[model samples]
Target: MSTLPTSRPSTPFAVVDRDRLQANIDRVARLAADRGQALRPHAKTHKCPQIAALQLEAGASGLTVATLGEAEVFADAGCTDLLIAYPVWWDADRAGRVAQLAARVRLAVGVDSVEAVQHLASLLGTAPGRPLAAPISPPTLPELVVEVDCGHHRSGCAPQDAGAVARAGVEAGFVVRGVFAFPGHSYTPTGREEVAEQEARDLAVAADSLRGAGILEPWVSGGSTPTVEHEGHGFDEVRPGVYVMGDAQQWELGTCSPADIALTVHATVVSHAGGRLVLDAGSKALGADRAGWATGFGRLLDHPEARIELLSEHHAVAVMSEGTELPPLGTEVRVVPNHACNAVNLTDELWVEVDGRLVESWPVAARGLNA
Candidate 1:
């Protein structure tokens, strides 16, 4: 007895506006180029090779990922260069996989301690013009990047400790290429600029320390969606994610306007009661990441003032303000989730939209590759 919203692709599907996505790509690429920084956006945000190709076309120097599985996925998809931004803990079994991957593409590994560099050396054998166990070749050794603490304090060494780490890499016959850090502390609403400054200062100190230890030409890399606009001092590269598909957190932090959001969940109204409407897109469709300061789980596109107070596996409870109208059952509403990364991991493909018309689909090839 009810008609479905055919204008919408389907309930609980992620829709990416083609034009907005391209605009985001071009904007970030141009800004980085003008600022003399190489942009190597984290692929963990979109996780789609099509999107990665678009970024490459827009002049991305390389790609960054959070896990080896993601690196494998992208490498198989023809990404020639990638950086595993996380300080990976590799067991003997995973070591083989790392070697196999390094043999194929230009790979970089992040490490914060001498122990990590030692483990990496044992795995990759020796660097160029060196002797090692089993007489392994040099090109298979992945480049080692010392990850220094830049105020987020998640998984990096102190500025003073970077020299020790880089020296250890050099001793182990690994090429210590550069330094990188993630300024996740900028994710808050009020501290974007300050945390970005912290990132720049910390990185500058670490780079200087490496140079003092006789490590010349140390490349510095740092950036995040919250603090990307701030060009950190001495940073030659930036690895920013979530900018490609901004979420509610970025909007709240003033990083981007509503028009800049390229990804949205298209959900249909399934029920309504007492000024509250339920949508078919819930945690299964949208991500379950609620920032400490987030007002709700997601925001409605048309009704920006509404709040998604509760979310289940199959339903999103949207609470409207006083005297606000509710969308009728079977009506479709677009929701911008709180975290685009997690929201994207929940989907298999993104429905591409251009000028209110369905154009194509982009597969999330690296979804569920957390290992």
Candidate 2:
């Protein structure tokens, strides 16, 4: 028989099961390795260096960050190989900062336009008064990856225009590493497989186009949590972030099951009125992201029959389904947020757990580092 931890306390916090997370990490890492591809898990999910380190230990090559600030945080935490996987605009001041960052780590910046590449080249050329030794050759500047649109019509260049973008980057004095895409449309329930297939085809086309432009394309990356499981061959790497700790959205999309949900908010029932039981956690604790298809604000683990009908800043009113008993006052309930990423950003720390034992609290160091 297994013994529960006596030190366990009831607190409203995001609890991460080490075993489940590690299992997921290992499985995905093996899947990628078997395909002769690399797994560069996106760090935007947990935004915790410890979790990122676990991914690296589980055969992940490195990490993909969405912002420069996130890259800096990870770099400072001893992450040498980092990819800022978003198209970023750089002014004179921002360029100086990026140049400084480039000197510290093996960094790759994403580009979506010729103008962005030209700006980055100008930044790399001027080392901001810090010049390398006579023959050292000013630190082989940051490598650039062109963004392909894939299926999400967001920030990427068109698949047919990939060759032009790669040529433009080359002409601007930057080494075009390859191309990347987001494929965010895969988050929907019905379109996941189709979106993943589209991502593979788009990435393949983009790679061929880049090669046609005389550019030696190396990396063809794209992925998100919902579509990662259906990923196809040909891409050099896949970056899926939310698989670390699934949320209500992923549950509804069928990317994760209830047992796979490793994180939840522990809230105490504070009030009871009419036919509803009010919990202390609301939109502030659980995120306010309600997709059109999402069932409710969040699913109550203990009371599956209860519907989180209304959510205010600090209160959640749960209406018990017909013929269901209402939870008494002071009852503790667990809730999975609609979106884990937003919920994480709203909190400063997370309560780490293992087999129902409270182990430690990890700070969200990169929570507000959106700049």
Candidate 3:
């Protein structure tokens, strides 16, 4: 069992168990190594430099971010290698920021279209004309990675069309560093293993197309937390974020067990009337992100049968299972949010706990940097 602090600080606070955190980090790192692939975990999950350092120390090759702001924050924290895994729609101002970051760190940006490559090239003075009107040359342009739509119908081109975009990137003076895809469709109750297989097959076709375009042996990358366990060489690197802080969704999906959860919202039972237990940690603290299949807004850490049926700005209405009694008023409980990424972004700092004792606090340094 994970230890909790003897004296709780306050209600609606986020806490991370140090032992569970380290174990989770080490487990994923080993999984990648055993499969002969590099581990580049997505930092958008925890958004803490402290957690990033732990992942790096566990032999991660680099980190992945969702935006330029996240890349800047991680770079400033001394991360040398980073990849922005989003197809950034660029403007002049954002282009300048990306260029500055590229010069400082080994950065790579995602591209799914020839227009994105051309825009980036024009901004760097490598292409003919600037399309966005405001053109300023920068010292260096980041490397490019073509995103392939494995099965997720979001933000990627067909596997066969990857070469056209990659060839355009090469002609625009950017080194296209292979292809990557996220098996987001794998986050389901079934067919995840098949989705993993499809991810590898899609990435293989994309990599082959890159090879046909004269980009020899392109770096293939695949995997989300749900599909990372599918072993075999369909990728050169794996990026799985939520493995570090197993959430309620992951627990319900059987990706991680209850014992693997490392982060939770520590809330107090403020009321127990009307046969419903009310928790102080609600949407504001736990984050309002529930998938269609999610059982509730969140899950109780100690009470497996409890369900958070309703959520207000400051109250989480939990319905306990039959024969279960509600704790008295002022009782402290832990809650695992449906999505750890959104939950961590909603908080400013995470109280670190070790062996039931209060340790240090880590700031959510990259919080609210969603540009």
Candidate 4:
């Protein structure tokens, strides 16, 4: 396994391997292209304009963000097409922002309820307290993508219930672009193929329902890192984020190999006592995102036999397998976070490395924009 930089700024900073990063990006782009599906990668994972630009340059049709704040950041950074893939309730402030963004970029958002659709329509009719310069231009309304529950049952409506929301969007004068779903249940050990099929079937049914309700050419969308490569199956677009930076969960889930992992937290072993090593990075840097099946808080990039058993704000306790030698104190090591999205969000910037050498720094431009 390749190691991280020896002479680094400090411990607990994110280091992205440029070579591996580009390989991951190209692999996904090629897959989506070959499948004849648009790749609008979710930006909530990296939250960096530099990475988004690479994705776009590699043939991404657009971007998928979790929040309007993220949409605004990408818009400012020159992403012309974007989707806020969350069922956002448009309050007064958010309504104004969404409207303003729609006027500039090809923006679409997820919707799951007629009430939210109605609220969106009512908000777009006028400017705050006054009538618009002209009536709400249907062409200018942010496009809507009805959300359908493909067994995740997290936020989307049932697949059968998607038509009502699509109808409400059309009635409200918004161009109902299509349907979307996050098969989050696919993160399990054996759920990827099953949920990918479920996502495809459910989206198809929802699209047919949209057509039944008078919508034509409803765009189908679905994908997560674990399921993105499992064939889109009549999908027009896919939005997978974590494939860009493989995490410990992906590594353990067999979704990605260690060589495919592009990002890790560079930390120094601060102590070695009682046959255990304590590192400077903890939950605050690597993120506390252990799933029930996860072996530990994180993993060692170089030492696959080592497990990060515990994490505090600034310390991580790692235990190596019996017979493995413990590193000396002050030895720098790389820690692969359990969840890359959360890990990236905790830092302000990523140290980009090429061929094991520091190259540049990419700011987490969309960090803390979860609102």
Q: Write candidate 4's Cα lDDT for 1-371 as tens digits.
A: 12344566788799999999999999999999998999999999999999999999999999999999999999999999999999998887888788789989999999999888988878777323535533534437789999998998899998888999988888777889999999899899886888899899999999999998889899999999999988467789999999999999999999999999999999999988677999999989998899999999999999998999989989999999998888898898999999999999999889998888886788899889978
Q: Against the correct fold, how does model 2 do in TM-score?
A: 0.91
Which ranges of candidate 4 are over 4 A from the true structure?
Answer: 1-7, 126-139
Task: Find the 10 residues in a row with the least total lDDT in model 3.
Answer: 129-138
Worst 10 residues of 2 by lDDT: 127-136
Q: What is the C-alpha local distance difference test score of each model?
A: 0.87, 0.80, 0.90, 0.90
Instruction: Give the poorly placed runs of model 1, Cα more than 4 Å off.
Output: 1-9, 127-139
Estimate the TM-score of every prediction: 0.94, 0.91, 0.95, 0.95
The CA lDDT at 306 in model 1 is: 93
**RMSD in Å for model 4:** 3.5
Candidate 4 C-alpha error for residue 116, in Å:
0.7
Predicted candidate 1: what Cα RMSD to the true structure? 3.8
TM-score of candidate 1 to 2 decimals: 0.94
lDDT of 3 by residue, 261-304 (tens): 99999999999878899999999999998888899999998998
Per-residue lDDT for 1-371 in model 1, tens only? 11233464558888899899999999999989999889999999999998999999999999999999999999988899999999998776667787788889999989999888877677566533445645444347778899998887789999888988999888887778889999988888897888888888888889888887678989899999878888645679999999998888888878988899999999999899656899999898897889889999999988989999998888899998888878899998999999999999999888888898766777899999998
35-89 per-residue lDDT for model 2 (tens digits): 8888889998888887888899888888999888898888887788888999999
Candidate ordering by lDDT (highest first): 4, 3, 1, 2
Greater-lDDT candidate between 1 and 4: 4
